[model samples]
Target: MDEGAIEIRQLRFGWKPGECLLSIEAFTVGRGERVFLHGPSGSGKSSLLGLVGGVLLPQAGEVRVLGQAWGELPASRRDRFRGDHIGFLFQQFNLLPYLGLLDNVLLPVRYSRLRRQRCEEAPAIEAKRLLAALGLEGEALLSRPVAELSVGQQQRVAAARALLGRPELVVADEPTSALDEEAREAFLSLLMQRCRDSGAALLFVSHDRRLAEGFDREVALSALTAAPGGVQS
Candidate 1:
């Protein structure tokens, strides 16, 4: 069986003509491994995640998830595949304002039929379990609007939401920016534990080098810049 790893062969992307934003000659992320990617601002970290999550198409070569080429799939199929295979956590808590915390966490199910079917329990139950695991278990808070929660609580809620469907790949972009040292460590521990439990490969991107120490491996995009605006298959 093919392993659930992200494999890239000569992947390149550019929004504007003649100026490439990202180009990876070759890169692979193994299952159940935590990888920290450190980049300064405008290093194309977000773009790399966007490619892996199937949000942006590669200009050349291929991006494969679990051995299936992302570019080969149709746009609709690609979206579904991304939803089922990759979980994205952005710095800004993108939770819906009107939806309650639990409801916000269940957003993936609304777009992903596969996740909805494979969910072990009803989504509400699953959300509660995830919430508890992330250390937020007050019954009164479950139904509360996200605006009522502190930034740290919102971060944990986002973590729970990202990990809810048990995606093979979890892409987190500077998620701990708002956290203090103690809170950051606690959050990292829970997220790493959950990723291990789910057997997901965490490709966490951060601008801070301190966070890289906790991960199993680290890779910098500067090394993979062999091709200026090209990708080789």
Candidate 2:
């Protein structure tokens, strides 16, 4: 049994007082499972990802990501735990413009000793290997400042950063929105292949249903969630 995946029991969350937005009876994602969760734009999908990635706390019940409940750890420990075991890819690409592509890819290692020690080949070697596998070339751009790279290049670098340390869980929210159909397909395939290679559980969130067909499993938020039961929007 892959008990290291996310397990939610009676999960409920909301912003304001007395307003419970996400209400889930139960949900589980097994290890190595590539899950494509789709929902409408305002359906609390990103919030769900936030909860799974330990960025948000539930008003009731519990959220367990990779066998550890987020609430079970102290706040500081939760931050470190997220840095060590989980890699999140936001649509923004979140790379520092001043840093080089190699440095941006190695950023996780600075905060995560486990990742640093595991990717021990002088760090840059691992970054290079990952970037190459991710279909990126040209050391000139790799060493240049991040602001100089194109959007696609930046996106690939973001992927390298997310997959660098072989995090147990990789959460991506609308990562392919900016790409065309061909690019989207290529990126999705690469992401799935990388997750399989590293044995990481992928939880990818997007509103586009057509792009989700290739994943190991598909989850629709409307099927598993109710907005606070009696609560209003």
Best by lDDT: 2
> Per-residue lDDT of 1-233 in model 1, one digit per residue for the tens?
46557889887788776656777888888887898887776677767877888888888878888888888899999988988878888887667888889888898888887777767899778878888999999889887889999888888899888887778888899889888899888988899988898888999888888888779998887777654533221
lDDT of 2 by residue, 1-233 (tens): 55857888899898877788899888888888999988767788877887898889999988998889999999999989999988888776569887878889999999999888778486789989989999987767667788877666777889889988888889888888888888888888998899899889999889899988889899998888966444322
**Highest TM-score against the true fold, candidate:** 2
What is the C-alpha local distance difference test score of each model? Answer: 0.82, 0.85
Listed per candidate, the RMSD to the true structure in angstroms reads 3.0, 2.0
Q: State the lDDT at 89 in candidate 1.
A: 85
Clashing pairs in 1: none
